[model samples]
Target: MKFTNGYWMNRPEYDVESPMETYDARQDEKKLIAFAPFKRVLTRGDQLNLGATTMTFTSPVENVIGVKLEHFDSENHGPSFKVNNLDPDVAIQIDDNTASLTSGQLKVSLPLRTDFDLKFTVDGKLITESAQKAQGVIFNHDTKVSYMREQLSMGIDEKIYGLGERFGNFVKNGQSIDIWNQDCGTGSEQAYKNIPFYISSNGYGVFVDEPQRVSFEVGSENVDRVQFSTEGQSLQYYVIYGPTPKEVLHRYTQLTGAINLPPAWSFGLWLSTSFTTDYSESTVLKFIDGMKEHHIPLDVFHFDCFWQKGFEWCTLAWDKEMFPDPVGLLEKIHNRGVKVCVWLNPYIAQKSSLFVEAKEKGYLIKRQNGDVWQWDLWQAGNGFVDFTNPDAVAWYQSKLKELLNMGVDCFKTDFGERIPVDDVKFFDGSNPKQEHNYYTLQYNKAVYEAIKDVKGSEEAVVFARSATVGSQSYPVHWGGDCLSNYNSMRDSLRGGLSFLLSGFGFWSHDIGGFEDGADRPTPDLYKRWTQFGLLSSHSRYHGSNVYRVPWNFDEEAVANTKRFVDLKLSLMPYLYTQAAHSAHYGNPLMRPMFLEFSEDPNVFDNSTQYMFGSQLLVAPIFNESGRGHYYLPGGKWTSLLDGKVYSVPLAGQWVDEEYDELSLPVLVRENTILIRNEKADHASYDYTKDVDIHLYQLSDGKVTTKVVDLHGDDVATVTAKRKASKISVNTTGISGSVNVYVHSDNNITSARLVDGVAEIDL
Candidate 1:
């Protein structure tokens, strides 16, 4: 995608036609159009045989500006992203020298009859610009391909992030990234969820409106600009303005899609029958019973790919030999108060009975010819289901409907990343390259709709693997295919943080990594990863060629699993409230430190430590030695586990300490009203009753916190005010009994709700 050899000249084969100046400007009610010829139109004859880059500017949502640069308008086939266009009222004005459009606090200005400078500003302060020679319509003479490129100027210390679940260095300043969804593992540069959107450290974000391949050179090619290009005759992108990072994401999600909060029970511990491991009804029961025997709370039990035969995947049927009575087995698990999730893919292998039927009915993706598209990558002779076909979607959902009727709760929708593009044809005749990443959307949408039909809308969720722009509508995507090691664990977390920052609300990863030989993920690593995984938004234990049962490791692994699982169940009162807020406001459940502490320069590059919600900071111990290193911005922090307080200076402070097998740094911020239920053993229960309201630091101010029920709906509100030696408490919609504590004071202060009010004197 790089057309220039260096800063001075373009490569020899690339004919780069960049706009020099805008000769004329026109305005309609909704849009501003500027015509910029490739060369200086000094003479009247200069405009005869030359082409121009047609620039159009408009607003979809408040404070967001969309820029479309076109060389020649080509016919666009139908599979684009599901962008929400509010079409807010915008101000369009064209004077003699400039054409500018303003929407809310954001404004886009284009100069007239001068050097090309398309600048974006917020409140009259320059954010970024498309400077001279930055917009190009390039034709590679050697390859006979055309591309539209746009380079936005970058600030000196500006950093870029979030190209969708990237596992490399968190700051994406000096990287060449291609937005292509691939099935690469967590340790590679390739990502399963490659989104053509990036958030800037300058408190804004850019989204490339191309489902097809969009390559980005983030200060890598030019060293002072972020260059993004797509192969086609046109390129369209949006610049969303946020004075803060959270506001930027709030607006971004409004344009893409908001998350649907998953059911509360889905947040608990999920134990899976690992891939290629021997598992039957008996084996699954043993693992469930084992968890019970060890005093660990389990919520869901998942069956991996072997649920069906090896080659007959997405028969979407049960392997009779292994699971003779899937219906009864699901009931048995449900009777134990656990849900069931089985793995599924969009590909239907030829060995499956449904494949021939689909091929005959034209339900499978077809080639340029009349034959079905067939491949032999993961399975033998598999064909992708054409989700664009309504009948095909209904047929596929009908198969899942049988399973859902048989007591299956949800599905782990997997393996949509390997979609074939060459000579492929979708039912709706969508562009093949564009349909590659978008196929996951349609596939997951079909399955999600099926589940929502059976269960209610609030009960539907999918553990998806691949995603594009609007996949946030589906909840709970996990980091896929990680190796069993400490490095991979760190990589998984880095990738998960990146994805959350990309507008996803919930995500999870394998407890002890997904890939290793059986009898792997050594006991120490299992114990460490268990703590990290249970603290994630969604917790699941899965592996390849190994059973992720905690008892398979040492006794300490079992103890560690029980410890964290119990802790999560206890904190459901606080966690679910934050989750509901995250879903409603488009803020992430697990966010990077910089998002919360934007004013501190120390947290800009630190992804190792993250804010679990708005109150707690969790630093997972990555090394086997149990030494934890974390930084805290100027405030008082107290460990929830040990009640140790830290008073960090205004300049920020880093702490290095060692932990045991079952402990790490889980700190609460000053003046935080942390609600918990320590004695609870279930994830879904009445959160308003028998709660532990721990007020950290008890700073001399009033703070209010919300309490939500199991359905993620607010049921009550708690307010605490500390005035000198007295801390007064008030509650609404909550009554009866509650225990209160001061975290920095390190003592429990008993309180009873008398007429929805209580007061404790220090």
Candidate 2:
């Protein structure tokens, strides 16, 4: 994707053309287009023979301006375009020399007199602008096509993040990224999910509005500017501006769609039958029973592949030799208060009994030469399902309906990343190259819709692998194919943070690792990863060749998982509210340090730690030392393990703390009230009655409030106001006495409980 060699030279065979001067401008009621030449034009005759270059300026949704530079507009063989949800009678303002368009608070202003004076703003304040020579049309003669490229200003020390589940680095300043989805594991430049949106430290984000591949050079091609380009006739992108990074996400999710809140049980621990391990009903029973005997709470039991016989993936029949009585076994498992998940892919093997029917019904993708596309990668003679066709989608979903009828709760939608691109024809006549990465979206959507139709909308969830821009609507996705080491574990956390910022509500990963034979991790690694996994938005234990039961490693690992799982389930009263907030707004559950502490410069590059929600900070131990070093902003933090309060000064510095296998540094932020469920043996237990509201250190002039779900409504709101010597507590819709803990002030005179409210006097 790089085209430049130095300051003045292009690559050997690539030709780069940039707009140098303006020629003419035209205005209308809804849009403005400007024509510009690649070189300086002295007269009207100079615009005559400007061969093979085009510069255009227009708007898609008002307030968003698109400037495209094209080298060859004659390649008119693109697919039929369709962009929905546009306002045609939008408000627009244009003058003789300049024009401004507004959509909500976002505006794009273009100076007709200048060549590249394109400014983007929010609420009448400038977010960014492209100056002279910052816009260009690039042509690579070797490929006989062109791209639209744009350059924007970047601050000297601004950090960039969120290019979609990236694992290279937390800050994406110096990486060359492509928006093509790949099946590479957690330790590579390739990513399973690639989004063309990036947030900058200056509180703005840009989303390249294309489903096709878009390449980005984040200060790599040019040290001072961030450049992005796509190969097409017209390049369109949206510059979403907010004064804060959180607000930027809010705006971006408004443009795209937000995620739905997954059911409560999906947040609990899921124990899976490892991918290539051979197991029968007896072995599965032993694993589940062992987890219960060791007190490791499990919510969902998943059966990976091999549930169906080999080479007949979509047959939808349970292997009789393995299960013998599939429906009876599922009912027994459900009777134990556990849900069930099964593995499925979109590929239909040639040997499957339904393959001939699919081919005869024209439900498979065909090549231009009139042959069915088949491959031997994961399964022999595997032919993929053509999801672009509605009949084909129903054909695939009908197979899953049978499984749902047999008591399957959810599915592990896997392996849409390996879709074939070249020499294939889709049923909807979409370009195969464009459908390569987007197939996962349609594939997951079909299964998710089926589940929603069968299991009720409140109980639908899928643990998907690959994703596109709007795939966050599917509830839960996991980090795929990692090694069994601490390094992989840390990178997985980083990837989850990136994914969360990409608008995904729930994310999980393999507890130990997925790829290698390091199945039995050292006791230290197992315990540390367990703590980290339990703190994630979703927790699971999955691997490739070996089992992931807690007792398989050590007693400490089992105990550590129990402790954190219990902690997370107890915190459901708080976590569910966070989930509701993320669903209603655009904020995420697992947040990067910079997202919450944008004013603290020390948190800009710290990816080793993150805040689980708004109230607790979790720093996973990545090394075998079992000692963790992290920083806390100026506040009084209390350890959740032991109620010990520590004061941090104004300046931030790394503090060393050691945690055993059963603990990590869970610190309650200052001036916050947290609600916990007293009983957490099951994830779906009642969370209102017997709930404990733990209030942390409250400073002067700080008012804390707690809202618990009262009969499916947030009817009860507890307010605590403190002024100087007395803390007055007021409550509504409650009938029990509230227990209050004063944080080590030593100036308390007396405390009284009055009508379900506690007032402490100092």
Top candidate (lDDT)? 1
lDDT of each residue in 582-629, candidate 1, tens digit only: 889998989899889878889999888789889999999999899999
Clashes by residue pair, model 1 = none
**Candidate 1: minimum summed lDDT over ten consecutive residues — where?**
742-751
Those runs of model 2 whose alpha carbons end farther than 4 Å from true positions after fitting are 51-92, 103-106, 121-126, 702-715, 733-756
Which candidate comes out best when scored by TM-score? 1
Candidate 2 lDDT by residue in tens digits, 4-113: 88866789877766767555555565555566667767778866777433444444544334545555554433232233334534445667677666665667776654
Clashes per candidate (backbone, < 3 Å): 0, 0
lDDT of each: 0.90, 0.77
